[model samples]
Target: MTGGVPEGPGDDRWGSDGGWDDGSLDATARVVDADSSEEERRIEAALRPRRLTDFPGQQRVRDQLGLVLEAARRRQAPPDHVLLSGPPGLGKTTLAMIIAAELEQPIRITSGPAIQHAGDLAAVLSSMSEGEVLFLDEIHRMSRPAEEMLYLAMEDFRVDVIVGKGPGATAIPLELPPFTVVGATTRSGLLPAPLRDRFGFTGHLDFYSTEDLVKILTRNATLLEIEADPAGVEQIASRSRGTPRIANRLLRRVRDWAQVHGRHVVDLPAAEAALDLFDVDARGLDRLDRAVLEALCQRFGGGPVGLSTLAVAVGEEPDTVETVAEPFLVREGFMVRTPRGRAASPLAWQHLGLTPPQGSPGAGAGSQDTLPLSGDVGRFSG
Candidate 1:
């Protein structure tokens, strides 16, 4: 949903306002460099699948993405702007990198928060080589001015530079190299309608199925040289919140357990023991996840509690609670959202081995109180 009216003074033309002449570009560059440290760069490079055939799951997205890149190659032109939306760690960043790799183009990585000023976005856009992929992660968090700048840049391959302050400011249109913008967001809903429409193709990644996750785990285990049985991989995959990142993380933990315990390989029993010790259930619920449900059922009386209240109880930011903890809780039928707030579902109580209060907003609740909570945000558990 669109946020309320803009606050403060400035012409909200999509990037014509020279408001970003501030040092936002330098700050963004620094942050991007920090994120691309030696270790992070190594891990991302090692794990990033080089081709669509190597990328796992999201068949529809793969097909569409393949066609877009192929068509762009055939025409010898930059590909259409692409939008990748899904839960965090569901491979949006990976797909963006893959798009660049597939097109044999360089990629410049940045984020919405990094481009606090329109000037920051302009600096990056202008610096990109022709046919490069500008991977903008967390695109939803970009400032208004920067987003506006991005619109003009994407549409016309140009940006207007304001030469002076105040009424005497002159607009200088600077042509940029033809490039592809690959926008990735965990909160696609927060994007402005105009910004969202600028993309030629949008790829929505869904939670991988248990089978898909198992395949991913098996592949990663081989890559990491960790010995794991088929059943062991299946067990880990089933408990990975249908996320490849979670599966990878769990595999690492299980490997540590196996090594310490002197097991030659990860077996089903060993996997179970390792997960139990880590407090991750077969359904992927961890300690904090269960704690959230328990607190709602026991302390808040099956809650229609506000998000802030839940965050306070859990000692997390409201964004973290809403984005990381709530998605899977809702998807597993453990939570429900009402006009009042968030309430515990019957499944939540059942998972916690507690019964809901009589007449609580459970199974037979009326249609009006049931707001469809998004399952994408809660996958990571912060």
Candidate 2:
């Protein structure tokens, strides 16, 4: 027996830390990286509509983008560098890919975080061929150095490479190949003003309408070969938070339910059952969402609660609760943002199975007490 833990005869040549013993560490690293890359590729590919025609929703954006791309192609020039801003899962990435496809150009994808230094961006830009689309996702997060380099690259098609250190350094103006840059960001507000002004075109993506989401769900269901009732599709669409990604995900879950329950097609019942299992309520509020409403109703008496206070009550980041959960609630008339803070609408109280408190200050007055707050209602009444 060996003095230390025996490594077995064949394992003696390798180090004790499992380095090279079986190449496990290397294999593990490669596997993890490969899996991550594969996932990214899958997302990029799945959400990428093969052509503008396959893209189901955002009709206005589609029409406007079609014109821009066509004009660029007719003129035989690279399309204008575009900026897309929107909430996540609203098809910003898809539109970027569509722009490249429509322009018949190769798109080199990178993110703000990937360009750690000016040199990093210079390397990527310098390597590009003519007419390439450089997609910088989350461009707002890019380092200051990289962003400064981008200003010159976007405006002049050139970069000044500084060589050597300190006193010995000299900037060599290097001409770059002409390319279009498409930047996508969830927070366009965070992008520096100078950088913001550099893009030739900016597209603001908004949440899809229930009708658009219905169309998206039906199209995806047809493609996936799942038989879904129109009513089922509509139900799923209404609950999807006006996002195609969420709509598609809901459709798939309902399809799974149909399959497991031996139903030949997904009907309204199946859709309801699936959504119930997923904890998406009739108004599409999930558990976390319900918790927020419940807190506002029961704890704060339907609340003029601040966002930070609400987030603390729900145990979530204020931003996440605001951006992700609150939008749907607001859209559905379950909540309203007040000058004071956030307050639950009458519908919100109803949804939470709670009676609207008597004489709640923000509750619209003179309407039948039973009536939920309507868009036309005044902010306050005597």
What does each candidate score in C-alpha RMSD?
A: 9.0, 9.9
- Show the colliding residue pairs in model 1: 14-148, 14-149, 15-148, 15-149, 323-377, 327-378
| Residue-level error in angstroms, candidate 1, position 282 | 1.7
The digit string of per-residue lDDT tens for model 2 on 108-215 reads 666787678888787677666788777788899999998999999999999999999999999999998788999999999999999999988888888888998887
- Candidate whose TM-score is highest: 1
- Stretches of model 2 off by over 4 angstroms after superposition: 1-47, 361-382
TM-score of 2: 0.82
| Global lDDT of model 2 | 0.77
Residue 354, candidate 2: how far off, in angstroms? 1.3
Each candidate's clash count: 6, 0
Off by over 4 Å in 1: 1-41, 362-382
